[model samples]
Target chain A: MTLELVVTLIIAAAMFGTGIYGALSQTNLVMIMMGIELILAAALLNLVAFWRYLHPDAIEAQMFVLIVMTVMAVEMAVGFAVAITRFRSRGSVEMEEAQELKG
Target chain B: MSVQVIFLLAFGLAAVWFGIVVFRTHSMVRSALALLFSQTAVGAMFLVMQAEFLGVLQIMMMATEMSIMAIFMVMFMMDPGGLGEMDMKHQRKLSLWAGIIAFGGASGLALFGDWGPIATQIPDAGEQVRLLGIELLGRSMLIFESAGLTILTAMIAATSIAVQPPHRPKETPDKSKEPYQVHNHGGAA
Candidate 1:
């Protein structure tokens, strides 16, 4: 209900939008992964904003955000590891060329 | 507006600007750096919002992650400098429309949706942190332990996968190659 909360939420929304656009438009796998990271970041921002605004007394939301951060870190590491593996085998990380997964 | 609001507005604008540059730049390294700046600004916003521990954690984690990401960009990108003028993006128009629609929907929901009553009584930062610590080690101990284990597993898995495994009769390439002989000096760039 506060202006601070409203502004923060708006920023989070913009960030999520940008992430969607980047993930959809990028041809490179790394770029797409970056987009996904953005989306995760946006989600984090939203969670923290809501928690700080609506439920500051409750610690559950903080814990949830921490868990989300852990997931984001692990996901990025694994995603890039896969990208490197693909690059080593296929010589490029283009999503279009990953047709072997079309089964 | 209060000083806190002013700081939030400033940092938020910087974050949003850098976020836009993350996708706009052609150079992979530049994009990574831009994202880094954007994320750091977001962390600063958290600090201004009075979540000190979370804000610090956000900055530390993102800094480390983004540095590793930049190193990976240089290692794996075919043209890190973008001198080759590669098309880093595709379906631009559709992407723009999609982004706009998403923003509109989210903003609408955020502005008009009925969220439960905002808590009027809030504890101070010290009390909040104390309570958070207790909750983490007490009721949520299992979840925290599981997350820690998963993160450890992820780190080990990433390292094992990334490092080249020794295949046939371990020939040490680094040991075999002599350190610079300085023969017929190739002209410096």
Candidate 2:
């Protein structure tokens, strides 16, 4: 593999690792969402990298990446709404302490 | 050195650096911001690979989404400043081990795999943009529309739920209780 590809891969891996860490580590609801967003970005990195590597000729990968972007926007809107509801109802946003649905 | 190699190295190093920052930080907003930078770097790498469409998409989506996340952090989260340290209770060791394994496996793959040369030589980069536009509007039309609706719904839901109802003051005393003599005295005054 070329050095450039190697570097890209390394970055992508780091993004992935950090994303997982964020998603898993933070207890605050917003923090967890941020972590999830990071993970999504990491996954997008992998997609874009592969797109550049093998599909330079076709625009398919690029188009697909755009779709992912739209999805991300939608996710943020919905996620924030859910978080707001939780905050309003319970007066807190910490995921660890939320047990309204627990049996 | 080839342009691809140079672009890859720059983007890769930036991503890793930002990624590390994201992991190390306790603040959610900072982590989100770090992730945004890392995404941008990765997008740059995509441009190097000549996948202009994906690269642009990466920047637009990743950056905007992260910004929205920051907004949510301010509005909903009790501590808008993210002043306190994150609750890192059980998964620290597990996350570390998983991260290490993932990194090692990725590095090994990178070392061994010979990613072939760029698939096509573009005589006109402009045409690629037109083609990408066609693809997005044509093949991905439904997906795009749905995404718009989803965002709209989320906006509505968040605003409706987050805002508290205005408190209405009770004007009348309970019928079970006698009227206060203070009210009659106040009327005389």
Please, what are the lDDT tens digits per residue for candidate 2 over residues B93-187? 78677767776777678668878664445524578788877766788777766767776776777577656656735457568976434335467
**lDDT for position B38 in model 2:** 78
Worst 10 residues of 2 chain B by lDDT: B179-188
Best model number under DockQ: 1
Score each candidate by Cα lDDT: 0.83, 0.68
User: How would the docking of model 2 be graded?
Assistant: medium
The window of 10 residues in a row where model 2 chain A has the poorest summed lDDT is: A1-10
lDDT of 2: 0.68
Model 1 chain B poorest ten-residue lDDT run: B180-189
Please state the i-RMS of candidate 1. Answer: 1.6
Clashing pairs in 2: none
TM-score of 2: 0.76
Total backbone collisions, model 2: 0
